[model samples]
Target: MNLNSKIEMQNSRSSSEICYENFMIFNSQRAGFTIVELMVTLVILAITLGAVYTTFIAQQRSFVTQDQITESQTESKIAFNILTKDLRNAGFAYPVYSNPPTFSGSVVPSENNNAGRDALTLVSGSQQVATLAQPLIIGQNIISITYTGSARFNLTDMANISIDGIDFSVITTCSFIGIGTDCDDNFVLTLNRGMNKPIPAGRPLYALTASTYCIVTDVTDTDNYLDLRRIAGIATLASCSGALPADVERVAENIEDIQFAYAIDSDADGLVDDQNANGVFDPGDYLTPPLPANSKILAVRVSILATTGKDDPSIEPSTKPYYSSGITLENNITDVSNDKQRRNIWSMEVALRNPR
Candidate 1:
């Protein structure tokens, strides 16, 4: 009611009105986020989710690739193991012969009246003649062998012939002759004594020749594969005698290439003789011995190239690092010059079936 009281009352009323307006503005500001802020938040969330999804996908792909690699490695190892095991047992005969079998130089006659008579003659150790005294008749399991020449013989069967000593039956038509007379010659057998007179004498009987055959269903081209045949029989020549049994078999398929290197003990140190005297494994510049009777085949390095992916996916191209100490495929047959798919190779080392 006084002058000072009147001024204070007027100021108080103005302040109250300003307070009400400020409260209303604050409520409106605090109601919700602005459009710009909402959009920025959503964008940040999308970016984070995208990064996480990308990382997850990358990891998943890596896992898949690793799994595929492991599977390929496992398959290759299995195949190699099986092949080595069988190869080591090749040319095995029960009751080892007194003298190894030898391949005779006699030509198989085409008119022998037998389906499997085209086989090269097998002689016993005592028989040194070029021809057999008795013609190797069909279904006759007994064979004599001898060694007469410097060359060793590998007898492969043209028909499934059972050995007199061995019990197992061999596959037919997949036979071969190596290091001795070439079985590729076509000849005709005659009843004349002069034509068959070259048959050797005193040669011990050997098992009938066993053919080695394999089914190559998945081959893209026949030329890419070698039709390796097995030959089992006797030898009639010099150091070779008695029932010398030889069996060569096709133990594997998909063998894109085969290379043989001899680990000869030239110095006879009871270890692989280093022909180059480099004291290190110089597979690139090493000496290879003659086959069929090399005597010491310390190790056999094999490389097989195979394709897992079919024509559809086009086989994803990739580059992988090789371990430093790992065996390089430089000398592999599959890795020869001008080979495109040699990168996909399985390598292995096999000891000879007969180390002697």
Candidate 2:
């Protein structure tokens, strides 16, 4: 081959080789993604994150709602159980209550304290942890009683025990419970036993405890929410309507309202008659306030209105479905809480265990 031709061929071959190498380097450098692809990937990721966030929010809200509902229901149920146990012991005489009443209910305006709800007072025999061989007595330094029921009687559990209408404060006895007992496990009064009027065996003597259930304001929310409380002890029902009892305890919270009504078996029939004919009661069948006579109190109907203490913000804030609870609160403000709080009313009829 000619020298000029050979040089031209070699130069052409080198240029082709260089061009191939340049193409390979360019392809390697372009290995990643374009701006448009990156943008598309980001949009997909954003959609996925938004969906996950929405689900998490919904679940959290559901948990809050469930918790509120569970708490309200549990509190209400507890109150109901306590009331049932106490009311079942009302007028707890051997056969039936015949006297002017060791107890009374639907407390008057002065004792009730609040306007919307009703209160009830019940009396029963002091429960005993041990048996009794002899009669109970009031001694010089202490007062001890012969007990017959299953309820345990202790100084800590009992504030003021009464004999008829007389409170323990008048007995001039030590506040501590006596521990003296005979062969039958009967505890002694540990006082000057010479003086005391033993409650007649047939007449039946009791420890004389009293209970009053009503609605009142609590420390947490003194303005809107209300709580159910039991006011009890000496001189509550036994004495005249003068002052409220010192012993008070909260039964439940979020109790919006409580109402008490009396039922009578005027005809001595087993079933209660519906009075007022609104399909609810017949005239003289139900009494808002029990009659003064002890025999008139046959059965009691308790109605409790409860609510969730928390507000549901999904609705208009502070705006309730019901216009009013039919009365104003202690704050002198009407329409109850200023938010949407769920509420419900529960009613129960309890028959007197002992009645004339």
Candidate 3:
């Protein structure tokens, strides 16, 4: 071939070989992103995970707060029910005294230095175990009764005779007139003291009980939380004159506060004597001096505040105020805390069933 034709062919061959090498080099190398691109992707992943974590934390806090609030509400409700039952049962088959002996009245209130916190004492007659078969005469020491069910009366067991729903007598000595056997059905009871007034036939015989409700610390628990305590005692002559027995029972747990307001007919006018002009018998109207002989208890207003028993970090400190009787309760003056624990308040007004 000619020299010029050979040179042109060599040049064309060289161009084709260079293009092939470039294509091979480009295809054989590993494909990857740049540092900037990788960094942007990582930042986006971190943001997404942060958002998810934040949402999870918020939801956890909400659940915990709700659970604590529910616990407080439940405890408050339980305390309210117990107080309602006792208040309704107060004065049942019991006498009303104007200047009542200590712990002998249907309702007794004790005021605390803290405005809204108060303690209450209630007198009630237990279930009727016996009924008068014959009319009980005045100054009678022996009585006849018909047992409706179980006879729980024993020797030296203090018995109460509700005479015409006015006069009350306590029997210090009680013995069944039976021949060495259990007292059942119709029986006789010999009393140590005679009745001051006559009781009609079919009058009920009951065992007296004096229950005092108060808030006290639960020393048995490691945390030493407060509890709604019920202290029960027999309403005998000695107990009425002296301090109450220490038959303590924990009614509800985590009870923070309890307050009481009484409705009293101080003049026997069959209406509440609102001395504070706040529309109810509140703090200042509490029985400080002994009530007049003709005064009668009509109703009672009760307030109970309960807590979750644990502090929650998510919630703010409580700023709410507590009130009882028309006075605001200050926690710090006596024993107050601004714990971040959830709290619930329950209130009720109960009317007495027995005649006042």
Candidate 4:
């Protein structure tokens, strides 16, 4: 009883002490979060990430929209300015031509429409010309001119001559200006290019060039960006549109459509000559018409539509058509597959300073 029982009791006491120590260590180590707490943290992190992403997307959309609108406005302004400058010079013949430039060449206003878009063909007689000193009748080639001017003339520069609206040149155009002595003669002009009519003295003469402006889409492009295109300084309008001439250039891109309407001064009242069927000459009650070919056009109203070439994926822009200055562009051929892209129309009125 003394040694055996005492030893057994000692062993039991040691085991109990070890068990107590382990229990205490376990309780101290279990001081972590519960499942619910961990879940709450994850939820907060997800919400923060989602908010940041949403803000980023919104800012990106705004950037795209603003950029596109600014681009369209810039292009429209450039095109309109160029067109106005050219049109104003329609009849301004540096030397003056018997046949000065006119609003429309020969075709009717109906024919001016190509592919549902307006086609503008105008002659530019506002070129420099050598002045004549002597009056030459029909079939006469030798004509005297002032020998000297601000710009000296070269024999190789002999291309075409116009006076009183008549063009004189051979197939190769005027071969050369032979020096001669005649009535105030500085130089003599020789021509075989069909000068069948009589010419008076002291006439304005210059070279000839024809220009036409229109809208077109190129063949190689996947997206027909409805660009503003032109056939610059060709011999005739017939050679211009059948196939784009080598000199054709794009003035502005993303121009959906361009239109022009002539202001006819039929009544000659000088106030836009608004010929309303109501017979009341009211303000803004203007008219667009079958203006006589080669007749006089006092004013021209031009409408242009432009767009952002791409769409904003995040924004839903307006689907309605553009309206401004009595010009309404309905569901035209803008090729807006999605309403995300922005588009607008601008209108302008330009007066023809020189009319043929």
Candidate 5:
């Protein structure tokens, strides 16, 4: 009932009021966000996610395009390597003749023949498949030869009988002496035509092949991929015009077109003659079948066009550019301008290493 007791009560009351004010402030601070704040946060998160997703999709599309381009480049490189090697070895140990050679030159070119595409036939005797077991005399049609297990001689397969690697004769007939016996190691090959020159004993006999290279679409493949095909034993231009043989192999795939230009030594000066004074070898400078009497092919320019196997939807057909020159690619098929496919062209100039 004194002044001290009354002051204590008043202090306690003031303390309780302060505690209540602090609790109210705490509760107000803990209250959830406003609807407008939540919407704003959501919009920001959505924008950030959209940006990230867009970047990822762009990168994925770029990766796909690069992968396709790499595939096309690899195919082109393989085709170029094969063509360069064969062209360099053209005329390797060709037959020497007193008169003009019965066949054409070692590298026969059919320029712009197959639907505006070029065809080439290469003759080489570097693949030695057998050796003469006995001396071959002139005017002899039959001779004894020995070979290893690697020698695969089939009927109608041509072979060259060479003497000292200079004089040679082609075997037209491949009649074997022992029919019932296993002739894997040794056999007698009968040449319907007499030998051009006498080959001594122990000389190597080479397996001759006329391989023609051209671009075509394989009907056997469900995708109908464009392929570079090597037609073995086919030497004439007609070989490029006919339907593909069932036994033919696809040397390279995705090859859309092929072109050839020849550097000829028309004057026989041992150097390439431009013929038309142009720096580049044009179609006019090429040599066809039944080549001129003294003209020789020194080098060949091969251009191959390759394409990505699939069409890219990102590439607009209206904006896509045609990589190949305007030329017919196949029979009833021409260079497509709106295919929406990526394409590349690779060219190689190869000098003949064994020019006869």
Candidate 6:
């Protein structure tokens, strides 16, 4: 063998070996992605999933908030409707006297002043004073109504009395005659002792004249025994005074606030008189110059505040302001905290049944 031939054979062998090694390396490289590429792909997938999850959560929260608001609004509307209906029917039979008698004989100055009006004086038929012509005395349900009279004391011919001693003042054109017959004459005035009223054994006769007084402040106390006796009028439970007629009830246990604002026709002109003089009807403000003697309440605004969860969850902006500005209850004159709470609030407005 020659030296040149041997050299060429060795070179060819080395070249072959190099080519085999390169082929193996190229195949391995093409078989899979780099670690960096794999990591990037995983990161992109995580981001996409995270965005989708976050969007779902946001939508869920929005739905919850909307549901709560709807529930609150519905409850408030129902409560207001009930209250307005009863108030419109208040003092239905009695002629709205300009000089309505107060327990102190002092005229009730403001229509919103319920101190005496709410505390009805029950004058039994036996207590009716024939000489005075007053249907109620002791032992009777003396429901003093402030209704608009006929031509004798229509809205046009009446004036609001502003005297200090007079809670309700009126200047009438003639003897005020209410709608239909006298409300006092139509209904039978009987003494109704609340469920709490003690019944004497062996005596069908309940105490007609007792110093004891039955007090009702809220709807919960409006049971059959505590219910205000409806004069000659509708027989349905809806006609009874207060909110519920012993059937429907409040749902949430955390309810903290329930407020009322009355829309009154101060001048009996069949128009709501906004005390703030804003011309827009708002129930929160007291009737300007107070409700006239013969005026009627036309509408009501109700507000309720409640908590959802058992414990307050430390929500942001925990407290909310009143729904409407320049409108508030009589007790809220200084402190507007009626609706202040740790959880939620519901508010609404309603119109009364009958109004002058």
Highest lDDT model number: 5
Ranking by lDDT: 5, 3, 4, 2, 1, 6
Clashing pairs in 3: 98-293, 282-325, 283-325, 331-336
Error of 2 at 166 (Å): 20
Model 6's TM-score against the true structure = 0.38
Q: How far off is residue 136 in model 1, in Å?
A: 20
List, residue by residue over 204-290, the lDDT tens digit for candidate 3: 777556677877776779998888877775432212222433366778888877766566787767777877778865555544323
Candidate 1 residue runs with Cα over 4 Å from true position: 1-25, 94-259, 264-274, 277-299, 305-348
Clashes of each: 48, 11, 4, 9, 0, 17
lDDT of 6 by residue, 280-345 (tens): 755445433334565555665545444332222223333444422412433332222333223444
Model 4 agreement with the true structure over 136-240: per-residue lDDT tens digits: 777677766664344333333224445655554522322243452122234355664436787777776665555577777765578856677766544233332
Candidate 6: stretches off by over 4 Å: 1-25, 89-248, 251-256, 261-330, 333-356
Clashes of 2: 11
Q: Positional deviation of 57 in candidate 1, in angstroms?
A: 2.0
The models' CA-based lDDT, in order, is 0.39, 0.55, 0.66, 0.59, 0.69, 0.37
Worst 10 residues of 1 by lDDT: 109-118
* lDDT at 92, model 6: 28
Per-residue lDDT of 106 in model 5: 81
After superposition, which runs of candidate 3 have C-alpha atoms over 4 Å from their true positions?
1-38, 96-103, 114-116, 130-151, 154-158, 161-168, 175-188, 192-204, 234-246, 274-294, 318-337
lDDT of 4 at 44: 100
Where does model 2 exceed 4 Å of error? 1-29, 94-115, 135-206, 220-225, 234-247, 265-274, 277-284, 290-295, 315-337
In model 4, where do residues sit more than 4 Å from their true spots?
1-31, 94-97, 100-111, 125-158, 162-189, 192-206, 235-246, 267-272, 277-286, 292-294, 313-340
Report the C-alpha lDDT of model 2 over 279-336, residue by residue, as the tens digit: 6654346566434343245676666777888875555532543544533322122355
**Tell me, what's the RMSD of every candidate?**
15.3, 7.8, 7.1, 9.1, 4.9, 16.9
Over the full model, what C-alpha lDDT does candidate 6 score relative to the true structure? 0.37
Question: Residue 174: error of model 6 in Å?
Answer: 42
lDDT of 5 by residue, 141-213 (tens): 7877777446555544444444446666555555454663223345566664676677788887776566788
